[model samples]
Target: MQRAGNAFVDLIDDVFDNYRQFQHSNDFQQYTSWAKQFKSKLSHALNTWIPKASAFVLNLLSKLRTSMTAWWFFLDHPEVPPDNNLAERSLRLAVTKRKVSGGSRYN
Candidate 1:
């Protein structure tokens, strides 16, 4: 099941990777169809397994389900990156500056 989930994610990434070439063409409809199918599979997986999952896994799934729309931006706007790596990297500069200065000091 985990492998299946991973494959689904990879498939979504592969679909989005072609967005630049397809954004303005009918090819994008293929991605839209894939996105809807992925959502259905995800929902089915959750319904089938979540009840038997551990508490931690349940919580994690809750978070994923809640944030799924944001992650599925490719469905509505395929131009957006799939991950927040750039936003995360932007925070490194602030962290480095703080460390260079004096580090955090809070009560």
Candidate 2:
């Protein structure tokens, strides 16, 4: 389990490395090729790993499969961020207010 987790992290790191390169060079053609290859590789990985995965990991993989399009949207649209840090940051104040106010009665 530990080894599989490490391998998965390494694979993601490699993909991110390629993504950074494409971003730096501003090469849409190369990015498109990479995206196709990545989707194939991801599908293969999920198929290969999901069956043997523990329930926790299986749930994660299932969500990944279901939201695959949204997962890679950032690659298709450079303006879309890969991480939700900005969105989370934007919500921090609201979240804090809700917590302090004992949650809002109205949404």
lDDT of 1 by residue, 44-105 (tens): 76666567667787777677678878766656766675667799998999999999988888
In candidate 1, stretches whose alpha carbon ends up further than 4 angstroms from where it belongs are 1-27, 66-74
Model 2 residue 24 CA deviation (Å) reads: 1.2
Question: Considering every candidate listed, which one attains the maximal TM-score?
Answer: 2
lDDT of 2 by residue, 1-107 (tens): 67668767876886778777876998888877887887788788888888989999999988988998887787677656567889999999999999999998886
* lDDT value for model 2: 0.81
lDDT of 2 at 9: 82
Which is the leading candidate under lDDT? 2
